[model samples]
Target: MNVAVSIDARTALLFSPCRLAGLDLRSRIVMAPMTRCMAEDGVPGPATASYYARRAAADVGLIMSEGIGVDHPAALGEGTFGERNMPVLQGAAAIAGWRAVTDAVHAAGGLIFAQLWHQGPLRRPGSGPQPRAVSCRPDGRWGPLDGSTSAPPDYLEAVRPPTVAMTDNDIADVIAAFGRSAAHAQTAGFDGIALHGAHGYLIDSFLWPETNSRVDAWGRTLAARTRFAVAVIEAVRAAAPALPVAFRYSQWKLQDYDARLVDTPDMLAALLAPLVDAGVDLFDVSTRVFHRPAFAGSPLSLAGWTRRLTGVPAIAVGGVGLSRELKDSLMAVVPAEDNVARAVVAIERGEFDLLGVGRALLADPDWARKLRQGAPLPAFSPAAFATLI
Candidate 1:
């Protein structure tokens, strides 16, 4: 495809300035958070700061940092692909390290948000900073393994065992941990907070029925299941009143790729209403393909449905620039032309507010600037993931 023609076809609005949650952005393109698992002992260093600063100096509007474990003992652990080096937002060293990252991004004239995460039952036992800490399960059960997945056999066998359910105390502790992490993020100079309420993590496990099969108030009904997320949102909002909070939710999980959080548009609206009311400034809807319809009856994508339902700005992610979905082979050489055209069309139609580029940005930090300049885009290769380019 001709680069000039592609540029002409894309609307200028996509590359134009915009504002989200009171922050001014250079464009609508966002650098989606992709976990690199390179932090040593859960502490980010100079390399981490430089990696984000490079993207900021380019034309990327907003960058979502790699998932940072909340201030809970069991917040992170070895998962698929080994999260042993996962970063955290607690402790003096971790906070100081993140401060450098924020300072670098700011110096480069870019905005960033910290993605707070907790692994929950997906956390491998006898691992993480606190190996003795028991994995927190929603109802003492890992998610059903009898589903389509890309996970390996050994991982499945290890997490197959039943574990202890989260007591009321456990729930309170995790919520407080999120609050504490938010405070730490604020202190470290983060501009905003992004909660990883997706992909079968701790908070997502509570919202998913397959994992959260409790008869108590925490998981009795769809609306009731939102209590955990609501509390976390309220806590983050209180901890950092000036910063915006973005919640990411997905229909699929790493444990089960075909997972569905809601079957209908109305159900999705119901599931997200409380979180919006609880004080979410934006919704980062995760999907395998950004242009795919979210429901059976509507042509709207998941992010589109979210925006229409909750009246909140939604970020659409997943294969924005690459041709293959993230679950596909990382070794394969992925092209960057086709899907980006679709993303431009999606934005022109008002399907989503922000376009999240993951592997493409990982491959090239100047992706946004190149797109804006109508320069050639580099194809993504597995080599890009080996280091913070």
Candidate 2:
């Protein structure tokens, strides 16, 4: 806040109240979901409640909780590393645990969404709490391991062999698992549901052609590729009819940062049409940079194209209050206020409905409040990944 005079007044726009698909938010600033991998035995404890409540109390609007595994056996696993202590959305203990989290956030005057997740092909077979579960790949491929990837050598070698492609039965079971989890999230008192359909996960695997080479109804062209995600969305809607549903998707994958799902605006529009028809209330378009142009012809960002094409409210994220992308090291320090200024301009131009802030919030629980008060913000550090602080 101690940076530019140009955006002094417009910065207040981020702190203003806005309604997203009828879910009223206290402000336009959303706490983007970040994986913490701290829930023991797939259960969140009181510490989880405290972590979220602190941010809610400081006026961060609409907290999207860390990805909670669905009830599927292949839901949670060691992806890119030893992904231990991840939470799930089933059983009385897990539901009760999440209830406390929702209550705490609500008590602090914040609306929260449960990001239902399934690791898909990213799940290292013979790993996770359920070691016996099979890794569900779309075409029995883990994608090209030679691309620009952040996965380690050992992990790459382990998942190199093609696993069994998802049979019709396997597809049905995973879709059912997402529905069951949505019902549980509603029971736990969450305001809405957010689907982790991005970053080379289950739903995204079907979206990306490189991973999903199937000739069946579940894959092929962009329209056909949407079948899996559409089915998942329909199931969630059926289970929790009243809850708003948001879908998060990205062109880049954990397998390859340079991977892309769509190359042109028309292709992007084609990819998103079925999702809107299937009842997606919001689109969380994940990009490495929020303002970067999604395609060659237009200057519109991915989130911008999503809202324009689908007529659905979209959340724009990535490097919002930081100097670099998610995979880059945060060792170098730079004032993040410049990015916040850019966010104001984008929002004013109606680029996106909500601004998703990740690392900045992790670095400071009072990040939203500090912005509201025009106070200096703490620079993001690598150490922030060490703990739940």
Candidate 3:
């Protein structure tokens, strides 16, 4: 049962060199951010450094560290959901810890970026000293703590009403926190910064109209909704003008899976204009499946549309190296091979400038090296997370 699959380096665009915000990537394969839940109360440590360095040594072109919480009380709620004491990016000690990680990644001959984050209403209101939910609904509650055996919600309350709207000050605080975190990231010696604006998180909350119902300045128009992101970008750019800043965005939200940010290309362009104007160096467009067409009558995927619309470098993610959807893969119902063929095809077609490999990379840090060297991809099991560490 021994077979050798030799991947040609030329055909493997995943390994081809590319430029991002003036920084040269040794290859086009990027190690997407995955929460390890291993930080000490939102503080990273030596092990975190080694965890990232391992992937860099294995040939990851770029390392986007797991979302690091910014220096705000709201940011602390993110780690309460059973993540390892994930490190917060504040104060001298935390900054030094991150600097160690940056040094390790660079020493391994890899470029690393810190993914700045703030959870906003995602935090359970009762969980921390000032636990406040994003939407402030009376029925809103935090999920069960890690490893607790809580019964599932009854069908009636399962579909609880929409979240309470956030005030203007709440939004502004989050934006400022993002900028502060980006500055800390630069201080930590990161090669660049990636804003965690995707996945129905706080930034995405403002971007999507459904979650944001405020009639105020931050909620009236697409440009206004984009204000929070623009402000964060301006602050970060001011902090590190030479550093490349990437924004990760998604049309889908955790609250509503079927959410769509724009129904038309014109709307999409309008929404993105402020970000482009703000000097965002790149865009990381996330989708559940990259192969699916983004809009009706368009052959291009969401990432394709983003690049074409903004004319900025874009990274496409979602089921890149796996065959099945992430949920199915996590459930162990199907092998991961189902998605790889399509991803390879997308790479061949230039649907995106970079490929972001997620769980597969977590399953095997050397996934890129193995794929390019034609080695067998390791079996992807949920247990791989435990095994890797």
Which sections of candidate 3 miss by over 4 Å? 1-6, 78-84, 128-165, 338-345, 386-388
Residue 156 in candidate 2 has what lDDT? 74
**Prediction 1 TM-score vs. true:** 0.97
- The residue-by-residue lDDT of candidate 3 on 1-389, one tens digit each, is 12234455544666777776787888777888877766665667888888889888887888888888776776645332234455678888889888899999999889988888766545444343245434332122222222221212231133233454555566566667777887888889998989888765667767777656556677778888887788888988887776898889987655555678888878889988899999988888888787679899988888888888988988888877666655566547334453455555676776678878788788777777887777877556777655434
Whole-model lDDT, model 1: 0.88
What would the per-residue lDDT of candidate 1 be over residues 1-389, giving only the tens digit for each residue? 12222677465777788887788998888899889888998899999999999999998889999999999999988867664699998889999999999999999999999999999988888888999999998899877887788777777787778999999999999999999999999999999999999999889999999999999999989998998999999999998888999999999998898999999988999999999999999999998888789998778899999988998999999887666787674557777655567777777777778988888899888888888877777777877877887
TM-score for each candidate, following the candidate numbering: 0.97, 0.96, 0.87
Of candidate 2, the 10-residue stretch with the lowest lDDT total is 329-338
Question: What Cα-based lDDT does every candidate model obtain?
Answer: 0.88, 0.88, 0.71
Among all windows of 10 consecutive residues in model 1, the one with the lowest summed lDDT is 1-10
Winner on lDDT (1 vs 3): 1
On a 0 to 100 scale, what is the lDDT of residue 226 in model 3? 86
- Which of candidates 1 and 3 reaches a greater TM-score? 1
- Runs in model 1 with CA error above 4 Å? 1-5
Looking at model 1, the pairs that clash are none
When summed lDDT is taken over every stretch of 10 residues in candidate 3, the lowest stretch is: 143-152
